[model samples]
Target: MIILVAYDISDPGRRDRAAKLLQSMGLSRLQRSLYAGRGGAAKARDIARALERILDSETDVADILVLPDHAWSRRIEVGNGRARVPGRARPPGVHIA
Candidate 1:
C-alpha cells in the first residue's frame, strides 16, 4: 500500500500542521504540498478524517491517494529533477509523462 497525500491549504499554520501530521504517519514530503509512504486504505480514511478536523473545508483541500504497492512498477517520471515519486528510479531518457 502506498499512500500519497496532496494538499492545498490556505493558512500557513494549517499547512504546517498537515505536513507534520503526514510525516508522523511515515509519509515523506515529495514536495511542498505532496507526501507519500506505505500505508493502508483504512489508514488513508483515518487520515482523511483527521484532515477534516484540521482543515477548513471552505478554504482548504486535500487528497489522500491510496494505491497498491505494486503500482509503482509502471511509475513514469519526467522533468529535470530527481525521482519525486518514490518506489523506483527514473529511467534514462526524456520521459514525457
Candidate 2:
C-alpha cells in the first residue's frame, strides 16, 4: 500500500528530520515537504507514530495519508487515470508506464 505524508513545518531541522524519517521507511520524496511511501499497514502506522514523536510540539502541521490500494492497479495501464486533491498531487512515487 502507498502512504502519502505531507507536512508544513516551520523549523528547518524538524522538516528535514521528518523527511529523513519518512525516507528511512521507504518513502521517495515527491516534492518539498511531501513524501510518498509504500509499506504494510503495521509498518506504516508505526512509522507515522515515530514521526509524530520526532515532531513533538514543533510541527506546525502534518498529515499522514493512508491511501487505498484498491484505487491503484498493479500498473498504470493505457486507461489509468489520475485524481487531484488538496495539498499535494495524487500519485507521488514511482510510476510504471
lDDT of 2 by residue, 32-68 (tens): 7767767667876787688778775654777877667
> What TM-score, over all chains together, does every model reach?
0.77, 0.64
- Per-residue lDDT of 27 in model 1: 80
Give per-model CA RMSD: 4.5, 7.0
Once all C-alphas are superposed, what RMSD does model 1 give against the true structure? 4.5
Residue pairs with backbone overlap in model 2: none
lDDT of 1 by residue, 1-97 (tens): 7888899999999999998998888787666787878788999998999889899999999988998756744555455344544444332323565
Give the distance in Å from residue 35's predicted Cα in candidate 1 to where it truly belongs. Answer: 0.5
For model 2, how big is the CA root-mean-square deviation? 7.0
Off by over 4 Å in 1: 80-97
lDDT of 2 at 39: 66
